[model samples]
Target: MTEPVRRRGRPPRAQQDAGPGMRERILDVAREEFAERGYDKASVRGIAKAAGVDPALVHHYFGTKEQVFAASIEMVLAPALEAPAALVDGPLDGAGERMTRFFFGVWDAPATRAPLLAIVRSALNNEVAAGVFRGLVASQLLARIAQRLDLPEGEAELRASLAAAQLVGTAMLRYVIKVEPLASADLEWVIARIAPVVQVHLTGP
Candidate 1:
């Protein structure tokens, strides 16, 4: 009998390890790789190696390095993205408090904090990562906030930038730097102090 013919292309490596959660696994690995190496250095091949899959598989799942990085950012920020919606239904006066609570709620959750922290830390030290982080935050988070508020294009971006600066600064102090009382303070206490500042940034003249 003639020997069975082998497949023309490389055998399916991802299928060998593939299962219900393979995509998620790849995303998780990609996030870590991007965080550790920054956007410029992180590669599909490396991510695939770390994820125990083939480079082609990474390409198959996520078109390019930029796409993978974008997916990773979305995954990390999914919970926090809900913050702007708090502005939609409530009185404008309480919008800041709602937004603040929503922002901290995600950070306080242990499940999401690790990847979020990784991105923040990496962004701080790596210019390439910082550019990616800034683009994602501006496009995804800040733009949503500006849209919800219905401000003029220029003013809306200004307001969004100010709000982001306030929250990001607070996060750096409370979570990253672990400043004296802010870090150790109750969440409500921190919220109380921060809400007004954010409120001013969002709504003040």
Candidate 2:
């Protein structure tokens, strides 16, 4: 009998270590792709190719664009995401100060800003990211804040949204877009000014 065709050579080295690393590779590629192209124009295939993995792997790690977007922003979201409900339930006095503290606390961290800056830039220019950003605020920040308070129907949604618009704008000018005085001013100065507005939205008329 004709010798059986020689079996294919050993799997490529890239494939050799691919099993557990696919998730990390996908994240690395997705972060770069999202930063460069933004969410609207980014393709799973392109990201997967850049990462040297299959497009299906991207889906396997992150089910949808929304999930990928959220995952990417995980660092930036932590402070607000964790603080909303807790602060709202915490001591009522000095709520504005507490809120301000939390905002600066997150932004002040060097580790948080890099990923945050990427997400901020993406959200501004990318349509998909804009929607995902809105969704994150709605579900994670706004919803949580609203649930803890005695706000009227739909007020939490509105209030949280309004708070987001303000915070996002401030972040853009101060950190991401890096506009004039806002960017240069001391952190405390900026937070002091914005926190009241946020406090009003979160706590009062």
Whole-model lDDT per candidate: 0.81, 0.72
Show model 1 residue runs off by greater than 4 Å.
1-20, 35-42
The TM-score between candidate 2 and the true structure equals 0.77
Instruction: Report the lDDT tens digits of candidate 1 across residue range 1-205.
Output: 9966635334275364577688899999999997678676889989999998877777777787877877798888876775576554677778788888888888888888778888888778767667778888887788877776767889978987898798889988988889988898999998998889988888888
| The candidate that achieves the highest TM-score relative to the unseen native structure | 1
Candidate 2: lDDT over CA atoms?
0.72
Best by lDDT: 1
Q: Tell me how candidate 1 scores on lDDT.
A: 0.81
Q: Write the per-residue lDDT of candidate 2 for residues 1-205, one digit (tens) a residue.
A: 8955533433344455578866766777777787777777778778868987656566666877668777767635766688767776785445566766776667767877766777877887877787777777777876776676576768767876777677777877788868997878988888788888877876776
Each prediction's TM-score versus the true structure: 0.82, 0.77
Give me the runs in candidate 2 sitting further than 4 Å from their true place.
1-21, 63-67, 75-79
